[model samples]
Target chain A: MYLRGVKELSLTRSEEDHIKAIHTLTRRDGRAATNAISERLSTKASSVTDMLKKLAEKRLLKHEPYYGAKLTLKGEAVALQLVRRHRLWETFLVDRLGFGWDEVHEVAEQMEHVASEKLVDKLEAYLGHPHFDPHGDPIPDKHGRIRQRKTKSLDSCGPGESVRIVAVSETTDGLLRLLDSKGLRIGTTLVVQEVHAFDGSMDVKPKSGSAFSLSKDVSDHLQVEPS
Target chain B: MYLRGVKELSLTRSEEDHIKAIHTLTRRDGRAATNAISERLSTKASSVTDMLKKLAEKRLLKHEPYYGAKLTLKGEAVALQLVRRHRLWETFLVDRLGFGWDEVHEVAEQMEHVASEKLVDKLEAYLGHPHFDPHGDPIPDKHGRIRQRKTKSLDSCGPGESVRIVAVSETTDGLLRLLDSKGLRIGTTLVVQEVHAFDGSMDVKPKSGSAFSLSKDVSDHLQVEPS
Candidate 1:
């Protein structure tokens, strides 16, 4: 069965990038501003505007000149497909190819553009249908349905609270490398030893390791769920 | 050690396609004519000329307007890399993903453009450094060295000769499906039972299956080595 929500449409690589960028930006904000898209794509604002107009003309999104762009349902499907392909390739690189998590994002970025539904389906099966990527981000299913979890940032936990890292909200290479060095990963359980209110830093003890202090920047990006 | 002969060069998809087409054409003919490349890429001869000029300026190839295009050493390296990637991906699709041999070429064509040297290296290692692809064609080594085999066509064999399928020189989907339906595959042993010289039809008995008649067209593309 074809599980994709919408029929696969042949889109230019640039168009797919804009759709994904809009999807990511619109998730946090209701609409994606041209400036935000330009920054995300590292393209000029004028180019983003032209692309937005084109995407709007294609009925993939709604664009307001001064406001922003929001995805249509059709556009969201395409975005989800890209996300699925990206996350799957990331999982393959890290889990199967033995690549370090920090080094997989760039390669996966290039691989996600291989536009074959059948290839993705076979890969999903080969990977045993992983629910989450290496970074703990939920992978959208074939129908664009993402598994939802209710989790808060690690910084929100109080002293004595126990939690398990579910996902990292920020996945910059620096952040990933920092977490790797700290022996932190998805599913790592920790007990909040102390919360430094002054700087929003926290001392957290891993289930197996000694307590370590995490700066506000690091702790803020760590999504956790009560253990 | 880096297995690739030349440092990876960033190439546009179209540039990669042209380079690959020239490589394939030049294999049969000393030089790749504009019309041949145009036909291979399904583009206009004028467009092909324009691209050849651009590629020549990039020093990837030498373009003689009337004599057709010939790859420089750098261009051949690029072409071999593309071939390596394509064959490796095709092997992955068939050996790991369970895709039919007849159905993997198109998908591999799309995947071959993922321009990450690390990814390809890891993939080659993951596949245990496969020497040949699913179609029994030699997969170029990381250093762009293809394993050479001395083999003749099945049609060249006379009655009483024992042979084994080494590679299918023609990998068209139709041809592969025909081979598949006939229980023929790489490494399958066969004994020539009779030859009908009038139309070059030959009856051959598989080591395991019943004897079958193969037309000259089919046998011509089957590369075989004496058992």
Candidate 2:
């Protein structure tokens, strides 16, 4: 299930989806409950229990009676495939389809299950092997390799520190609208000029070969390799 | 070539390649030269002439007393986009990757013309809405829509006339081999009959509910109506 790089991994789409849901839910909550999985997958709890057992047998998830399950290394492989395809497709949609960054995540979700290594390889080649997708998520290379980026929230940028935005989170159009109003986007160089403790927001500037200030909360989700 | 049932009448990848070359050459040869075009495309001269005149009045190819010029609205939209992506990557290979797709015609040649709709949608979806790439294929969807499908091939049926195999023209290793061997595949039916041919193909009995004979060609192509 864990493709070290780009060799094909064997698992059905549903299995991968279950693994991914577990991974996501685990990231949010401490454990992956059967109810949580049923809610995420829109399936009956009974069905989730059935799948939990099936995955446990495959050593994909460590299931504990009444508690839920944890993804084993084997399961992690499958989850990673969903992640890889998800980000890759997101990038392709926004970059190649003329989609706004806010519009790509959902579409990529559906496209991620397409079964074709050659298609993915060709896309990577066609795309110059991009390292990120539309929402600023890192794309796993054919080898499932990820570039370790040193980044923190825009909120973390101290006054007088220079920062350039590499990506924005695509959760809602609200973020996109806010950024657009502020002229902030990936690779936009903005320096922290001042932070108002009174309102948790700040003044911002664009990196258009110029200096500027930005609000603090908006900066939190934005990753900046501060200089 | 006109694909049956393709209402989308966009100039195909091959058609665009022909247009680009024809446009450039029409400036030479005193006009568009069919023989030269045939040499360029490695197709026959007669086919080139047929396509040239067809394109000319359509405004893609220019022809005057066997002489020619360039594109028109109907032609340039498709031609320019194809040219834009092809040259962008062709140039990118030499400039970025030390080695291209063979230095890349084998792959690029095919990719250069894959339907822009699919390419743009998938690319933007995967690449993070990159506005531009090293190759400069305009890295965004010039057109907003893409066509996605769930169709499969027809080579996986048993000795029967009506069993729908689902899926089509797969380039994968498992599928190609399976189809070649007349084993498990997609949308394929055996149509029970004793071909009793001299060329050594199997002839199975009972078209449905049982297995029988098959021709290699029949086993290789032919998609069935959906079941």
Candidate 3:
């Protein structure tokens, strides 16, 4: 009964993707420009504008053209549901289905759109109420409560600093595969050996592997806690 | 690698629904009229015509006005994929997610559209490659192979006949709930005490329960094997 009372909001898969992209893009500033949304979703700015207008009319978000857009409380709730579904399915794919951490994201992306309150709650129970997803991101509970952790992107670590990989933010397959290839995962300890100033890449040494240089794009997606 | 080599076919939710409906309608004769497809989907015939044309162009089906639409080989493959996903998810919901047989269909309906071949293959394995779903429908394998059973509708049993429930078809919530109230499920044993020829309703007694009259609608969905 945990997922009870959440109506099956009939939003297209594209709409849900748009809402999630907006939420992530505006996470820091609390608003995201149409162009930023377009960039995140890999769509055109004009299409983003049209979708924003439609979403605003649906009262899921507030769109102010020439400026940016932010989720209304209703939109935030829906986004939380999407997030909860995504993380729960990710956990199931890895923990139960025996999928490698690097291979779960794309499948979970499709699974997350299956909107059933009962299904989500049942899966949560089946997974014994996991607090975090396989990617190390917090899995929101039924009430949209997320466990907060003091973690920063690996790019923020200075030379000689040792930290534990707590989460991976942008979980694209390439980044995950890169982390896999480097023997880095959630809880993997690594020390920053050097910082390349020209491209902002870092030479990091994992506890069990030789030191390697990771580009800014890869390092920026990695979140870590001081070890 | 089980689900490898299957391209993620891009089809909208509405398009998939239309294709599934047509697949069911044309299943008997390998052809279904547009009006029949529209009626089954509860949509207008003109709209069905438009969709049929689109599906034909996509090579999912062959449509001719005033004639019936028949699924092309490609269309049958896609429809079988949908069926495979539906039955597999139904098994997961009931057998693993702890959902009742009656409560899983709607959720599985949403889940069946998740077009991830890897997820489907993983789920099939996770469920130990279940042969039949909770409602007694044969779950299609990775190659769209279904297990056939020799079962007949409960309405087909004559008076004084004994039968065991094998499967339930047309699993509407109302019908399943009705069966649940009557303490009937897969493998439940029952005896047909009397059959009303006028209406085809049967008065049957479960192995443990007293006799009850089931309307033709209810009996039609109940598949039974001779006991």
Candidate 4:
């Protein structure tokens, strides 16, 4: 299906939020539950139900009663466009504007809603068309094509396996701060020294820095490719 | 009075639109009338009255029954911030991203509503803290201070006078296009050759180009400084 013009799509901010939330949820869990969407958006589940109904009426998604919501092709396209905008703005904020990678998310959230294709295209050019954002998440191209790399979570790596951080699956401020504190970042090569069976904490040595221990919670969120 | 933090002075998009509209109208007409604001925002006059009342309750502006609205100090501060954001985005679009000056206004309009003080400050730094926008209108500083310039409309210039185009009073797409068609732009130096008193049209010669005639409608909008 062809991507509709932003003007023709004309989704409200709340509708867009729902579309993105559903897209994220479905990608991670195979289906978007009403409760998950509500929790993600900090909105009441009833309000989210109403919004899903409205979006389904617009043919953006199919909301199956028990199975939850699934994005139609059109809905997926809109979500991709939002992701492109969000990641591109994030890149601009951190790369061009000197914003810390940790601080660009909230500002990029607002910038992403500016629905002008020309603006995005111009910005993409100005930024030299970065394939990945500062957080290491792949930025979708204009055609919604994302560059894929085979990787697994840091927690999945066996001891003595060398890996480079490719992406952080969860971008929460707390997690980013933790990564920053440990000098762990995208492209940081490390060898898994040991996995403690006791509590799932892993000791890893960086290519340049000393060894450090990371909890399972943090390792599970760090996507890494074999070095 | 100190400028309020953007979080403390959060305004809805509609409220921000009304404030900018009133700021523009009052600057040109001494007072912002309900009908004028309605026309400017393309909203009903009754709705304008309701919004005016809400803004009055919020201490942003004073709405008189027949006289119109006047901004309080707090309201003026908000308006200046918006102006700062709008102009900075315009400068970025034109100077950095290579958008035509005529095409930047609508996109900048959308961008100006992304209210992050740090984003604005960083953007100002990224754009070299431009003192004037592409249109030659002074960009307000972080403290709501504007760099003032002494200029008069081109229509007010007498024949035999040399001047430089400083700003365009009206920034409508049509006027900008008209100026573009005639190769007229901010900083273009011209000499008034003859003023046709009959139709208020004047013949002007650019510093390095052939002489051309400009209608009073056009000349009146072209602010010029003595060259």
Candidate 5:
């Protein structure tokens, strides 16, 4: 992977957003389609195509028409920096500023674009270098090193098993608020009472809170490790 | 005065910089000249004129070709918000993140554009509602109420009078570094030993440090309260 100095990492807000969208899409589909990127950014496909070409010229990504795009090594490094900034700011917002997990994403989105290496370093030190954000997503370190965790979807656990929520994949504010209302969060332990094969929903009892039935959709979003 | 919601305060980076320049110049000269604003921003006079007209059309400023530009009430409010954000971020950098006073300005300049009112308010609370920034400039509150201080330039103090540093007006890094080298900073107390009529220079003795001489240019930048 290529590494770049902070000075060389200057990008407009739109460029950074496109790079991040491509990174996220690549993680899910192994390649990022122009249409998918456009959809992600709520922009037009033609505009996405134009941006893809510009990124290609800048050596951030490689794009082929009617096919897909992929972040180059240099591109991945930049994208990781953005991710690191985003998660670090989110951690600071929630841990230091008392913002709820659901409320930090938008503010962090703006903070991520500040892009000062020393500022980020100082902020990381100020926040005690948290390894994971409030949403349970691993925060990439300064060197783009992400802490790995062994976890599976809560929906995948069988009946009578105990697990601790490690991360939640679909991090919509609505989903996060729902989980909060249900007293489910990162590190919350649950004992599965039963999993209905027909509906794929499950009845789980939190170690402290009473049992609650969660739909397949909600359970699928939750990731857990054996307790 | 026209009060605006946070959403209506949207301004491009360049626009914000221009507004800030106008506000600063107005404070110093009572009117912001296009040439002065151009020089401050390092842009062309024609470009500054175009921007002035745009701002006038937006009701942020009133521009008279030869006279100068003046901010409307709406413009002053926006400028105050920008100042509030800048000082608040500078305070956060120095008071919370351990950044040196000389190094926080550029980062704060970028951060002031984030334009998230809630984020700013939370940050104010997190920083314990500091009334003055690290440089000793008053930080405006949410309603743009600025803390007032009685002060005079160090150069203006008579011989035999002692004063405590309250603020440094021309906040260039070179000047700050020079002040740092001389053990001069906010709250440093100095007694004027002599004032040379020849070149506006003076000899002074700090309360603790050895006596020293300062040029008029250097002394003029220092604001001090009678001690």
Candidate 6:
């Protein structure tokens, strides 16, 4: 894996972002519609359509009438690089800079497009080869390989089931705050003790902290892997 | 004093850069011409002209015909924020991420425009409130005050005078290689023992290592304050 390997392509901010957004939306559904992407990005449908045409012309995506689009390999490469830079910067900002987990995404988003492979590796080494970013997002390896998760929400686990919380959402700084208030954090072996359907909450006992209840909102934002 | 305070500006990459470049040039020379800026950045003179008009329209720069330009108070504030971000990132990269002194500049140049006041403070805290970056560049205080220098170049000193090498050119990685070969680094003390005239060279003794000869070209690129 060549970390400072030749960049496959240089992309404009808007274009690179559009590709990333499309990849995210298509990850589960296998394709993303113009309308969905437009709504997701808060951009108008017409602008989305225009971008689709431009991206299709650039061979970054496949476009066919009303069928929506998918990322070509070239597009995926750029998207992964963007994701790599973003997560790496996020990890650096939080773990090394003493920034709280919730406050890193906005700045990391802007830093993702920075064109330095060496910076990323040095940062990865500095952070001790962290597999996940501050928010629990998996950082791609030097070759842009992200480990597919064999995990689910921590709150959904059965009582006495051992699991490790792997990630959280950067957008949910408030939710992270809520988790903090409840004494839940990554690597804090979560053992689900109770589930309440009335409010869809869970009582979780961390490795050392006292047992606590997490609202459904908090549960949904956390990712956990069975140990 | 408030490192966690959020910033409110939404300047683009180029615009934020304009504010900072103007701040540096204005502070150094009291005035900066568009063409002069073009040369400093190695961008087209026409591009500088276009950006000058845009920055002026934003009330960031006080531009005059051929008379050179200056930053308004508003512009200075923006520039200080960027400088804070730049030097802080440089320190974070070199001190925390294992990036070498010669490697942080290009990365920091791109990172300086990231719009995050809180991030900078967190970084300063993470780095234990360092007063300087790897290149010996002063890290501005939270209040935008840069520490003044009390050292100068070893080459500028007369025979048998002692001095310390502070910072070097952001553009000279080769000079870094040369300096490293001589066991010289930031904070390393050296005494000018002799001056060579054929190539404007000089001889100096290092703090720990034996004496070595250095070229004038190398000395010119070293940005020392005094010792």
Instruction: List ranges where model 3 is wrong by over 4 Å.
Output: A1-9, A28-30, A158-161, A191-204, A209-217, B1-9, B28-31
TM-scores of the models, in the order given:
0.96, 0.49, 0.90, 0.98, 0.97, 0.85
Give the Å shift of residue B30 in candidate 6: 4.2
Error of 6 at A54 (Å): 2.5
Choose 1 or 6, whichever is better by DockQ.
1
The 10-residue segment of model 1 chain A with minimum total lDDT is: A1-10
Instruction: Indicate which candidate wins on DockQ.
Output: 4
Highest-lDDT candidate: 4
Give the per-residue Cα lDDT of candidate 6 at A88: 88
What are the per-residue Cα lDDT tens digits for candidate 5 across B151-185? 99998988999999989997999999999999999
- CAPRI rating of model 3: medium
- Sorted into a CAPRI-style docking class, model 5 comes out as high
Better of 4 and 6 by lDDT: 4
Model 3 CA lDDT for position A78? 82
Residue pairs with backbone atoms closer than 3 Å in model 6 (clashes): A135-A168, A136-A167, B151-B225, B151-B226, B151-B227, B152-B225, B152-B226
DockQ of each: 0.84, 0.08, 0.73, 0.92, 0.85, 0.70
* Residue-level lDDT tens digits of model 6 in B39-90: 7787887888788888888877777867767877667777777888888888
DockQ of 1: 0.84
Residues B1-227, model 3: lDDT tens digits:
13223365688888888888877777645678887888877899999889988898988887777897887777777788888899998888888888999888788888899887778888899899889888888877887777898999998898888999989877778889999988999999999999898998889999997998999989998999999
lDDT of each: 0.91, 0.61, 0.85, 0.92, 0.90, 0.77
Greater lDDT among 3 and 6 belongs to 3
Q: Relative to the unseen true structure, what is the C-alpha lDDT of residue B158 in candidate 4, on a scale of 0 to 100?
A: 93
Local error of candidate 2 at A125, Å?
Answer: 2.5
Q: What is model 6's C-alpha RMSD?
A: 3.7
* Candidate 1: C-alpha lDDT: 0.91
| Residues A1-227 of candidate 1: C-alpha lDDT, one tens digit per residue | 23355655788999999999999888867779999999999999999999999999998899989999988888888999999999999999999999998998888887888888889999999999999999889899888889888999998899999999999875889999999999999999999999988999999999998999999999999999999
Candidate 4 colliding pairs: none
